[model samples]
Target: MPACEITIEKIDFEEPIHIVRITGALDAYSFPDFEIKVRDIFEKSGRNIILDFGKLDYISSAGLGALMGFAKIARQNNGDLIILKPTPKIGSIIDVLGLSKFIKVFWDEKTALNSFVSKAG
Candidate 1:
């Protein structure tokens, strides 16, 4: 089995949104690490954030909880947290949980980023 690992890749976008691309399995074992990175991002800069999950392999309930937590924090800061390129598995979970009503999921980074820009402007 592959060891659970989560990596945050920074993206350079023209808008004021901060894109954090997360790649790897986001399981219970990796939730803490994931939370730390997400918390830091929200704490340091309250920017409209897009979480690109194109390369993410897996995610558990704990991982979803982390995302929800970040979403709540982002909302409190008057920012939004969106997901980009989530695998079908992850997308389905979000859909089932009714989170799709709160967060929008996009197929690509550009669309996700554009939505943020549109909302901000």
Candidate 2:
């Protein structure tokens, strides 16, 4: 399988939210490709994003830093990056790195979507 597979879904609410589904491992090798895709999303004015890690098998420090970078850019645009359904191993790593405090993590899609709405209001 590919080092990483990324799929983006745009949901149009008051402010559009892009759901980016990633699979496989997001490490140093795959981070460049993923970063390229993310730049495309930013070009399209995709500010708010949901990172669906449900199928993600692994993530490296590079991937985690990219997440932080994405979140910062989104936040600058008055939006944010939210994590969805990360695997236990990924969750453990995120917690260990103290990333969860920086980014929001949710198990349910509805809740995650509503979080953006709630932030706007």
Candidate 3:
């Protein structure tokens, strides 16, 4: 198990999006904590979320499954889970799994934030 850190930051956008920065490796070992923190945030407000993968080094199938679960919950509440600035390796994995079809990925933070507004309008 590698060092995994999940930090949740509230971005001051017009709609108030939550940016969850994932660092290090996200595998089965760390998925539990990640899921708890994210679910707590979602339960509090059910706001749109952006998973910032800029510092994330790796992810496993279990990690992806957790994300898919989050995405489903967000959608049910009229919110969404977006992926921001994924590393090339992580990006490839996500693409290969066709996760992009359900979760939107953005290269830029501003773009990802705007997507929430665009969808609401």
Candidate with best lDDT = 2
Ranking by TM-score: 2, 3, 1
lDDT of 3 by residue, 1-121 (tens): 5699989898765667899999999887888898898888888885699999999998988789778989999999888999999999999999999999988999999898889988878
| Top TM-score model | 2
Flag regions of model 2 displaced more than 4 Å.
Answer: none
The lDDT for every candidate, in the order shown, is: 0.76, 0.90, 0.89
Instruction: Kindly list the per-residue Cα lDDT of model 2 for residues 30-113, writing each as its tens digit.
Output: 888888888788878888889999999988887898799888998898889999999999999999999988899999999999
* Candidate 2 lDDT: 0.90
Candidate 1 segments whose C-alpha is farther than 4 A from its true place: 4-15
Candidate 1, residue 76: how far the Cα is off, in Å:
1.1
Residue 58's lDDT within candidate 1 is 84
Q: What is the TM-score (0 to 1) of candidate 1?
A: 0.85
Candidate 1: count of backbone clashes, pairs at least 3 residues apart or interchain? 0
* Residue 87 displacement (Å), model 3: 0.7
Q: Give the lowest summed-lDDT range of ten residues in model 2.
A: 1-10
